[model samples]
Target: MQGFEWHVPADQLHWKRLQKALPSLRDIGVDRMWIPPGCKGMDASGIGYDVYDLWDLGEFHQKGSRATRWGPKEHLSEMMQTAQDVGIGICWDTILNHKAGADRTETFQATKVNPEDRNAAISPPENISGWVRFDFSGRKGKYSSMKYHHQHFNGVDWNETRKETAIYKIAGARKDWAKDVSDEHGNYDYLMFANLDHTNPEVRADIFKWSEWIGTELPISGMRIDAAKHYSAAFQRDFVNHLRRTTFVGNHDTQPGQSLETIIIPFFKPIAYGLILLRSQGQPCVFYGDLYGLRGGPASLSRPACSGKLPILMQARKLYAYGEQRDYFDKRHCIGFVRYGTVHYSWGLACVISNTVATYKRMYVGVKHMGEEWTDILDWCIETVIIDHRGYGIFPVAAKSISVWVNDKAKGRKSLARPFDTDIYDL
Candidate 1:
């Protein structure tokens, strides 16, 4: 699911609604589900990305009671379990870069640096009031009693006493800035608020302990690591590899012209969704907004579900697309690929997607089924193609469309069985 869209006041009760939709999500061929950040944030209303307490997964009263805008701890757990029971892997979004909602402030020495060039020192190191301490007074040390101090952080943006926004590297910090971070704004390590120092052994140990603790407490299959480019690449590599988690590509941080508006531009659905589902590399994630044509406006705020081509694309992914892949991303406007099926599977799929206009492309499907016929499963093209002796066929695709041509042999097979569900979404 897309989780919360921009500026949507997603309440803690949303997970209860999701618990009811677990079976529906499985029916729609969601093998994995990406949930929003589960930790407590600056406020109950804010998304979990504004992380305040790592140990609080809607279980502490720190952020205006025991909830993190996705429902209470019990509701979140039940939803995860429900998804797991239906064979869906739960992918949790993790924020490890910066922290917010500090409980109190303290005096600390820091070096003032130029925002334009983080490495360039503008002022000599001096004592300044900083907001890097977190005690999590509400939780009462339920999960962890580890209170974060200014030493656990490398730098912060706002100067507490001056009430100003400027990047200040904490004094006695081992590293000036995190290495191998994004070059945006000179160094992207100090994103906002208290920047976690991955180099700090104590900080790293605390993170390790929290990661293990959460896994033992919750059912999580993978993680969506946030602000990955804002930390040490080596640290991230080690952490993800140690956890054995499946990582994805998308995140909230984007360039100047890369807003959600630009992403949802005209005719963007087919191309984006096609590339995601049709590829065999990483597991694809379908955004609920794109699935329901949810344009960013007042009317789209409550769009739970809507009829769209995503259902068909998901069905195609689950049923036919599999095995070894070949990419035909040679052209500018059109891209296509073929999936050679496994032995137990009856069908393989050849996909051709284009953004500009309709065109025909001759591609090889493999020599095993020389004379076999293939039909477009998505109906983007109705005409069938018969593979020649060379396993080559001319496939025509519609303009601004994603076409999936499945082997004729599997076209008549029964649709994949949906997991037995009670249809609780209506509740």
Candidate 2:
């Protein structure tokens, strides 16, 4: 699950907050947390995307502060350690396409390219001053001795000499925009700030070295590559290959007793969420903003907390969404499915979703579950569903809602029983 939202308050000491929330997150069946970028950005308030120093993860006294927007280095380390202790793996959000907040400016020959079509040059090659040099004085070459110069980058947006903002492709040997990148805006190799030239051997080596350093420094299980479309796909592939061959980071080798395959449903509303979560197929991911609500955005754009219903669905997914699956996709406005419990779980669930008005669906639970009493676990319908001798029952769902029907006598049903539910166990 995504651990943080885009609008999370910067002053909340979010690392510590996440550390405290690890236990509860695990309880809701989150095995991994995709965290935001931790590296120091251009400034203390700048999000990690505005990359200044990759090595300074809120550690060195750089970018006008000793700590990143999240928290200090110690807090991030502690949070990562806590997540590991609680059996939750951390997926770091990595930014590698561009670098921002350069230490100094340098004059270099560059050709002005049309913003709409980057391949089409608008002006002849001329000397233009741009912030393409990074000395990283605060780090003092602690983790890496390599200093970024104009040759390491492909292009920049602002030309300080002209005091104008436009796409200026750096002019040099093999300095053309990367070929394997998004076709949008003619060539999307140069996204923003100083775009890293993956073709440069020195740049690739330094990036590889940093990747290895971060892998050893932190307990990262995987990475979510940012701005992938703007960078060379071959470079990204090589980077992953390098990680797999060198360290345990990004190593996804399945171990004994591990489930082989599952899909990830990143974001969904109530009806779509129910359709995905209550099924026996993919692993549904609950969005962080959906659970805890959102802040720091326009007041009209903020979202209210959906913790009330989400946790219930998560618990249902954990306890009963398992075993043989059967889909009922007969109706247009309504659809349903049933999961025949595995031998180990022994109690399955039936889910019905209606996009329009209130509806009912007749589905089969299992022959073994014949004549069992069933009711909606979501408490959406007040009626009961009795499995006929053939193990078929008609489940009802409210208008534009979902209903998960489980055997009334199923074990562990009492654990998820609502406070107002007196007949859940008695029946």
Candidate 3:
């Protein structure tokens, strides 16, 4: 689940809030959380997008505060440790496209480019002053001693001297817009603020060093690159490769024996969520807004919590939905499949999904044990299905919904109980 929303309360002590809710989140089958950016932004209330200092991370007294919008360094560390103790992994939101709130302004030769087409230079190359120098005096070169200058970046949108707002492409030798970026606006490499020139070796080395430092400092399982399209793809690949080789970071083969399969379906409704989670494909993820309602947005724009539907589906995924599969995709609107459980997890299930009218499908669940009684674990369909001697059962699903039918006497049926029920796991 995403640990925070766009408008989560600025002073909510969100790190501690998530740490407190870790156990409950784990209980609902949330193994990892894609948390907001942990690095210090432009200010205390900055939501990490105004990337000021990556190395600070609420540690140094920079950006008008010692802590980011979420919390201080100590709280973030505590939260990460808590998540680790509770067997939940953290996916840090990494911002690498640009830097904001520079320590000082520096004079550099830059050419004003057309906003619609950055390749078309509108003005001649002239000396323009912009906030392009970052000494990070607060950090005092603790984690990384390398400071940033205009040569380290490709462009800036603002010229401090002229007080103008236009796409000013920083002009220097080997300082053109990166070619390995999106071709929009002629060249989309220059995004916002001091856009880091991935082509610069110093910039690449400093970012790689910060990536390693953050990975080792925090107990993070992975990173979600922010504004990835605005940077060099080659640099991103090399950064990941460097992390894999230098430290236990990145989403590659860092874990010894575990293969991570994540399928993040953002802003999916309950039915869509059911179709994905109750299947035999990739590991499905639950949206935080769906699982625990959204807050702080406009009242009409806010969404109430999904009415106790996701926990059941998540529980089903965790306890059952295993083994060999059989697919019945004869109809366009209706489809079904069966998982013939393995020896270790032998409480196989049959799933029927329909996007239109209510329907049923006859699917085989293996003829090994043919006389088992099956019922919808979702409790959406009250009817019970009986497997015939051929191991085929007619499973019923409601209109525009799904039904996950499992053996009525499945060994772990008790553990598939709904969340917040008093007698959950007592079935």
Best by TM-score: 2
lDDT accuracy of residue 70 in candidate 2: 87
User: Which residue pairs in model 3 clash with each other?
Assistant: none
Cα deviation at 49, candidate 3, in Å, is 2.2
Best by lDDT: 2
Worst 10 residues of 2 by lDDT: 418-427
Model 2: per-residue Cα lDDT at residue 28: 54
The regions of model 1 sitting more than 4 angstroms off are 1-4, 173-175, 241-261, 292-307, 324-335, 361-374, 382-394, 407-427
Residues 214-240, candidate 1: write the lDDT tens digits.
Answer: 788888877788878889898898787
lDDT of 2 at 292: 61
After superposition, the stretches of candidate 2 with alpha carbons farther than 4 Å from their true spots are 248-268, 280-283, 298-307, 417-427
lDDT of 3 by residue, 1-427 (tens): 7776555668828787787777877876778888988888877797798888899878888867887888899999999999999999998989999999888999999999998898999999999999988988989989889889999998999999989999999988877887888999998888899998888888888898888888889989988898888888888899888878865544221111224523323323456776677677876656555565455544532443335667777777767767787888899999887777778888888888887898899998878658988988778899989999997888898887778888888875766664543111121
Q: Kindly indicate the candidate among 1 and 2 with the higher TM-score.
A: 2
lDDT score of residue 94 within candidate 2: 89
Instruction: Please give the ranking of all candidate structures by lDDT, highest first, separated by commas.
Output: 2, 3, 1
lDDT of 2 by residue, 103-191 (tens): 89999999999999999999999999999899999999999999999999999999998799999999998789988999999999999
C-alpha RMSD for every candidate: 4.3, 7.4, 6.2
Better of 2 and 3 by lDDT: 2
